[model samples]
Target: MLKGLGESLQVTLRKLRGLPVVDREALEEVLKELERALLSADVKVELVQQMLENVRQRAFKEDIPPGVSRRDYVIKIIYDELTNLLGRRYHPLTLVKRQLTKIMLVGIQGSGKTTTLAKLARYYQKRGYKVAAIAGDTFRPGAYDQLRQLLEPIGVEVYGDPNEKKSTKVVKKGLKYFEKKKIDLLLIDTAGRHKEEKGLLKEMQQIAKIAQPDEIILVIDGTIGQQAYAQADAFNRTTPVGSIIVTKLDGSSKGGGAVSAVAATGAKIRFYGDGETIEDLEEFDPVRFVANLLGLGDLQGILQRIAEATSTEQQEELMEAFKRGRITLQHFKMQLESVAEAGTLRRILSKLPGVGKGGPFSGLPVDEMDDESVKVFLAILRAMTREELENPKIIKGTRIHRIARGSGTHPDLVRALLKQFNQTQAMLKRMRKMRKQRGVPGMGGIPGMQGPPF
Candidate 1:
């Protein structure tokens, strides 16, 4: 999600970096590009305009935050503005002190409400809560069966009438059954209904009234783009929608529209569904999400993905290098190889905030950049003398030629690889600047591991 925005914004920021820091004219131009990008991604115009204005005001405020540089100040302002626009805090499921917590899921057809119900149950179960699912979606084909198929293995109790013709009756009965069971959390998956369908809306309202849910959540398909917000607005007006869960985000969904919907409906994002796995649901963290959207990598998610892809011994070595911030080309090659097994370079990079989509090589054809080229590059690097490896600038024409001969590659190819390394160094410098601006402390080192990889 947000691959396009991330890529575009990264390029735009890189271009802005060449100019004077926080200059009035340059700031204005950058803000304009940002506005265009957000709007193009289906973000609400009001939110876009408000965010740009905040960025402008903060940039021009003149007082830099303590211990920050001028360039860092501007980046910080932009980051702060984006975070504010996304909402300052994550809103998790807050249960009442005395009564059982009830949650109702509503959305248009194909919004994945049923699956979301099971996912929610699993999420709460992980938190040590006894949860039950009431399959209120009687109209949809196999709604009960599908939800049960997903939830039954987890030992979650489900209440539903698979053969019931009337959704309202099915929902009413299900709620009563769960209520008697004394479930700590009851999640009701209502039948998907269009905003224009008044009968369905009224039926939903009846269910809501009977169920008296503590939270009303609207499930939106992330692929719907700007329409997701409109759906949220419509549902919010019909019944109180406390929050939203955007599903199918692993696909091509920009998810910018969902941010717009947050602005429109004033609903917090409770969770985001990245994939079909029950564990794919994640709690919403505005700051981390904004960082991800702006090409500032999701550090936690990256670590988790790495853990999933690496074996115990390889993971130990990788973690050691990560902590030391001094990884060898050999280790880098291994990481690249492991990530390649699960996805394409473009796909993997797109998911990373600082590396893909909107950053330096936003529009570059990463898919064409193959693993073989990376392997070849590693081979060339391996041929370099120890002094050349430690101090790259020492490798002049003669050293380059020697390295090329040793690696059995063309001199021109060696030169090209060196040039690419220089480009990557420049990109890393820019990232260090951005990270400092965002107040991500201690990029220079990590805690657990010590020293560089050999």
Candidate 2:
């Protein structure tokens, strides 16, 4: 969601890819560009310098592996360094199954802490957890109402008392209420407290003591840039923040600053809010995030999103078919349905290698296809016989006409689907060969059947 920084990085990588040779001089030029980009994005100067130093050492010293281009190797080093700058690995919320997991959210005022709490609650609720939110923001007017309005619609129960000015008392009562209900996750939204507000900070400590939260999350505003470090440090000093959530990243130009600063604090970033919607929160993954930023795409992230959009049974069936490399037309149709349900074709394509912004295939008209086209493709597949669907090679010109008639679509559309299916099969064959060469087990193919056809 750090659009500015992502675009800047992508442009720098694109220039590097065009270089005749990835020598020390080229590497130095690229690192200079990166330094400017990072500083302009408000990233901490020290972190940026450290990351560039690491990248420079590896880019010039590392031996290029067989079957890899020097340009690609340099790009890989940048990706690795940037990922490490964010966080080396993903840190998931420590929630015990079938037990109450109390998460206390603390941040400064206007940091979108209340909204983030709702997003977190919805995130857990979707995973089958019995989630309840406690609005302990006694200092903010209508904070309880705001949380209730955002949470109740999502079926997450909200526990708050506007009359109770004592935040600790509210948390204590909310904890008791959820304990009696045996809720799986209890999210406590504390009042925003600045470092200067010792009274508010002390109140946060009191609430933490009373709630005894399993995890204390500091929600920081992405617009704050490098100042996020001070905010997080102040909160950590008060209640010992275990995790961080950066909000409003979608609109913040300084998102890089906030994210990198939080990483500098040694606090794990558990989640990030990219949009205003409740479903916009996503678990932060360093590798995937950097991959997307570098225009390499995040196939794993796209697959995870697709899995979440589909049912458990559907996911299992898809995974089994993929493992066997036996993805049929029926399976392909199901995948398209899942992709449509998950997001638009443009969004899905943005996560595919060489297809996202600044990638080689970025100019493709993925945005032109809409729900109607997806439904028409599914209809054409439904019109096909079981044998033809299972063995697409059996579908000849005659079968294409018949299927088009049965599906009430143009024969050209049917032929287009077949062409797309053939392309997908070819891509899968190439992926299988690559996996074999790399000694990787399993199909190692794209989770979806095919890339979006322009």
Candidate 3:
């Protein structure tokens, strides 16, 4: 996920900050380092060259406001140029004023259009918009069933023929049916195409002409590197593509392909797929994304997720328990689940101010613990009655043995879990007291802790 690139650029920035004053020579060196990092990450060479040129031109321009530090001025210019390289703002799908907004998704095969459709449906559902997905991808086996299964949980209706062979007819009927039913948004997932497949391209053009979608989203796999630019360009010539959604960013080693695609296509990236969950899709925000790309944190998004997860009443209760040295194994299990949902721990920790390559426990293997282990721990907690969760002191050896049997884990594993839970409880008590002394009232989620937007 461009992790190395971010790390390298931060090191360069730190070196620049240590210098007495920023001048042309220092700026040139910094730009050169950044260009190398971007190119190494598989960003298009042309785009990288132009971006550095923009940085240099803006840095030396007389238009820079007075009294700004040279270092700060250069950073701001770089930020602006990067933001411009990425699409500046999200483009809302504008339906022809009075009609339903119909968006047809297109891309090469294996680009994740089907899953992205469900994610987008759920997003619209959360915003109180009535959405239904049409399984227009008749070519893919199980397309109808897959959409139905994934969208059913989110309460979105799926319209398609399980045995339909005509793609255009299916989409036409699906859209007409939904339009009368008054669904606010209709997202159609078309069959993926090879860039050079003339038959597929003609079929797609027919589908578009029949449906006349208001917006077309090109789903590009982020891991493909700069080759994604060519894929997007090919699709653009075949049919109008309104925006882009970069998928598989969670595991992409070189995400610069996403950046290069944005720069080359001039299409606003609408969303980024961060994880495998239905809620893992997030709107593309330039300022926060670049900050994260440069190894800076997105504290605001973290706080927002925390606020959504924990209620005010629960926060007060948790803080009170922390202050009383009563944090239990149950609470530890809940916190672990929350962290797991937030995304990879290392990626999250990497964003904090002082946690990096040389920071404390930086050598600790990230996510070494498996999900099965987490599940086992949760099972052990579930075996506990309310009394045991609230008061760990009462669980004697006999009870521990019974708990292990009930939870289907070894007694030694149970004991080890309890020991770790105790250590975490003690740490929380200390943090709680410090916060209380500082006049903070509750266990609000830690400030400046960034994790996945999901």
TM-score of each: 0.61, 0.65, 0.61
Error of model 2, residue 35, in angstroms:
1.3
Model 2's TM-score against the true structure: 0.65
lDDT string for model 3 (71-115, tens) is 665665675577666654445443332348889888777788888
- Report the C-alpha lDDT of model 2 over 140-160, residue by residue, as the tens digit: 899999999999898889999
Please report, in order, the local distance difference test score of every candidate based on alpha carbons.
0.67, 0.75, 0.69
Which pairs, if any, clash in model 3? none
Question: Which portions of model 1 show Cα errors greater than 4 Å?
Answer: 14-20, 96-99, 195-200, 295-454
**lDDT comparing candidate 2 with the true structure:** 0.75
Compose the digit string of candidate 1's lDDT tens values, residues 263-361: 456667888887888888877766667667766552334333432434333445655654454544444444444434323323324453322112122
Among the numbered candidates, top TM-score falls to 2
Model 1 Cα shift for residue 236 (angstroms) = 2.8
Candidate 3: worst 10 consecutive residues by lDDT?
Answer: 354-363
* Model 1 poorest ten-residue lDDT run: 354-363
Model 1 clashing residue pairs (backbone) = 6-358, 7-357, 7-358, 8-358, 10-358, 295-353, 295-354, 297-354
CA-RMSD of model 1: 19.9
